[model samples]
Target: MKLYIAEKPSLARAIADALPKPHKKQDGYIEVAGGDIVSWCIGHLLEQAEPDSYHDRYKKWNAADLPIVPETWQLKAKTQTRKQLTILKKLIKQADELVNAGDPDREGQLLVDEVIDHAKPTKVKKQNAKRLLVSDLNVGAVKKSLSNLKPNSEFIPLSVSALARARADWLYGMNLTRAYTLAGQKVGFKGVLSVGRVQTPILGLVVRRDLEILNFVPHAFYEVLAHLNPNLDQDINSQTSETFTAKWQPSGACEPYMDDEGRVLHKGLAQNVVSRINDQVGTVLSVDKKQKKQNSPLPYNLSSLQIDAAKAFGMAAKQVLDTCQNLYERHKLITYPRSDNRYLPKDHHKEASQVLAAIKNNQGQEASKVDGANTRLKSKCWNDKKVEAHHGIIPTVKKLQSASLTKDEKCIYQLISRHYLAQFYPEYIYNETQVEIEIAKGKFKTKAKQEVNLGFKVLMGKSELDSEEKLPALIKGQKLLCFKGELIEKQTQPPAHFTDATLLAAMTGIARFVKDPEIKKVLKETDGLGTEATRAGIIELLFKRGFLKRQGKQILATESGIALIQVLPEQVSKPDLTAVWESSLSSIAQKELSYQHFMQPLLQQLSDIIELSKTCDSSAFKSLPEQKPNKKFRRKRKTYKKAS
Candidate 1:
């Protein structure tokens, strides 16, 4: 008998539907004709045992119990999924061959692989196991995946990488959470101070931004614009007259009067420049014109999609992820929703016609945008080498059931479809013109960008179209008249508070925030702070823990959040550690680093952190409001009387 273990029930059903069937649904699995069976794990059937499970003394949070390192890590069946685990165990023993049919990512690899380990199938059966990677739930996609099953052993590095991440997180989060919570208790704070590998760094980002905003000092800056006309003799109101504005560029001699950013700090300097250029004749020093083409934005990766949804609809990251999951799993309308890669497999280009047809038929008014899409046009997004474990989230060829979708779902679906359709459209083309003018020994310049071809922008709506500015044809050394000069005053503004969109963007592009060049380089090459699947949940966890709150659409760190960051060590609060770990984790996935080599240093680091945490000041936590205890219902322990 062949046994297929899937990540979830929906996937199991999808796999079953693609097989030769006369299917019989059992309590926990489905039996197919030809003695094949398919079963599923409810997310993860097992999880890392709690610290208490390792030892009785570790049950309560204690300072002495710092750095609780497990000598031999153990996995215990999750209480809710114990029954499903039992059914899988029995099936594994009866099966002649096995297949690991999890989502094609690190976590998915570990979740199902751990179950097979827990079931303890015969060594021969285990070694002979195959892997089925399915990113789409559609029957056709699943059938294609079935024919391409590879040896499960080939992905052992991926499983190890996932295991290392899980254990590292456990070691880091569990120890730090306990160590910090105990320290907070010492300072009369009532809340359980939680610190995580990813969550703490996220909190640090917000707290730092908030402090920067609070301490910001606005400064005034001045600019001089030369209003010029190509024909000074022509009437100003005449349609034949061509006029434009150019900004004054300060010379090196004026450095003392300017700020570091090239903004003129002294209003007198700007006024003098305005007076010098007004109603004067200026010579055009340079005239450069070029046509540029911009390709449409690539297809939706989870982070990009989340950022856009947050911007357009003010939806939270979790809300967008949930909607995407529904679209991918239940509706089967799109591909995998947790991909970090924005590039699609080149082979997917073959299905462009069918995907385009589905978009045209399903989208109502938006369907019209698909009419001009040329399926023959291939965008840079179709790169086989750039495609990762999963391709970009795109609409499948399945017909849409628009009436069944919610308002948000419809919005999200349209976004994914639009991006995919945009791949087939022509590049947006424009003419960029730069003119440099010299007047009274001062330089003034202006740039004009006029649309040459709307291309994909036609489908993207008016907001995406560039505002056109026309410049009259001119040659270098050509004379023009400056009608008047205008002095503009501006103030430098503080950085904006993080919203759902900006926060997700920060998390994905965290390299921008790091100071160390080496770590920054590594972070740039890696998926940022958290994976696409966990970033939303991490943000939500902060809110649930009272560490973060929202003001309208802005995400702000609460007092408790700020205090926790203040009390923790710098390494514990910054993204540097995550960057280093991700670098090592990637190496582990590529077989360049061993799990032991990664964990040993981490264990030592945890010890050092716990040791340092003991000495840090807890005063910041003392000022925080006491956290109220959650009222949770506990089940009564039933007692049985012994019979004589």
Candidate 2:
């Protein structure tokens, strides 16, 4: 009997339906067409052999037993998935041929690799063992995959990459977690102290931002403002003879033209601009006109979607991730939500319209909100060439059904559904007009803008539409007269505290004081802190570690959190290390590097950090905490005596 393996049971059932009759199968295994018997593995059936599984002495945690580097890692049956293996092994041993039908991804590759490694089917019988990858697990795609099975060898590098990443994470997580836990116990803290190589650096970002908020001293400054009347000219403003007022701007607040002090460059900047506005009389100097259009926004990947939802609905980063997971996994209305790509494949364009139309006829929706452009979405942002591993997040027309969805989850889903439809529509078009006014010798400006095509605007809110509008149709030298005006003075404030949404954005796009331009550019290309998947958890880690605290929407650093990097043994908070680590990780993915190369340096850095931490003077930090303790622990403790 020929045996077929599937990535999931639902997918296996789909393939079975495509085959001959007798489609019903027992439990998780299904039979396909042409005498082909099919079955599925629930994600992973085997894993790297545990430390205790190898050596009895390594079973328990001890600081004296520092790095748990094995002679060579080996595969072992994962207890939870062992039942899956017992079935696959029994079938493969007696099968005429084995079809490897896992999902087409690194995780998928590892899933198959684990079975091949532990079950040893090839050792018993080597012939007819082949691997097949299906981009989509539908019946048609599955059938196509069966006809063109690729050799297991073709995915060797991918498996290698997955293995290396897994091993690297295991080595770091196991050793560091042990080391820190032991170290913490030695220092009188018995709690488990967990630290991930990726998680720690991310925690550093939150801690640093928190410190900035805490240590931040506001610098007060002043800005001058002027008011002008509206313009009614041009297509946007009004193509009329009536002119609008120019914008009020800062005028001389310092010494105009300066004395021997020689501070002011512009004599106009020294005099009080608001006081001068009263003395100001005006004339029309110029008007400029420009036709404009706001191009459609690209399809969102996980990170961008989270950012938008967080900003709009005030959801936390981890909350967004959880909702997205439901949208992809349990709900299955959208594609994989963990993807980083914002582009679609070339073939997806024609199918995109159906997506838009389906959204309009949404089974559980209120109304067809979008009635703008029925045209296609063609933008540089949607090109297939830019995508790798996975395409952008998109709805699968499954008409999302669940027992229930939380209000926030529903909002996030609606946002994603609306965005998907909007991407297929034409660009929103608009006009921009600008008018300049001269008051006594001072100039002010006003803008008039109008929407030409309400394409995606029909689905968008006022905040979204207003962000894209600009002045249109006012020509240079066009005359404008202002009747009413007012002056307002505002103080320059310190930078705003980092919100969770903004913090995530900053960490992903982080920058540092760099001496080298080339190095800075590389850091820019890579995420400023960590990848999209790791960023959210990292922020949560900071909060959990007491490095950052939230007051409403504002993020502040705890005393311990502030002192962590300030008194740290190394410059761990700097982003250069993250860039370097990412560079090595990328090399491993490209097959140009080995995980050992990455691990060796990290091991040394960690060891050095440990030693240096011992010698450091933390007297100042001794009184302060590395981070604030979790707030749950700080609740009022009402002592209760046993009933006497």
Against the reference, the lDDT scores of all candidates come to 0.87, 0.61
Which candidate leads the pack in TM-score?
1
- Clashing residue pairs, backbone N/CA/C < 3 A, model 1: none
**1-644 per-residue lDDT for model 1 (tens digits):** 99999999999999999999799999999999998999999999998887768997776667787889999999998888899999999999999999999998989999999999998988999999999989888888899999999999999999999999999998998788778877877767665677788999999999999989989999999999998888868776788789888889999998998888888899999999898888899999999999999989999999999999999999999999999999889888899899888999888999888888887776722766777888889999999999867899999988875578888888998999989988988989988899999998899888888788888888767734355556888899899999889999999999999999999999999999999998898888888888899999999988988889999999999988888888888898999997678778878988999999999998988999999888889988887886532221011011001100
Residues 522-576, model 2: lDDT tens digits: 7766645666666687678777876667889777666655555565533455666
Q: What TM-score would you give candidate 1 relative to the actual structure? A: 0.96
Q: What root-mean-square deviation over C-alphas does model 1 reach? A: 4.1
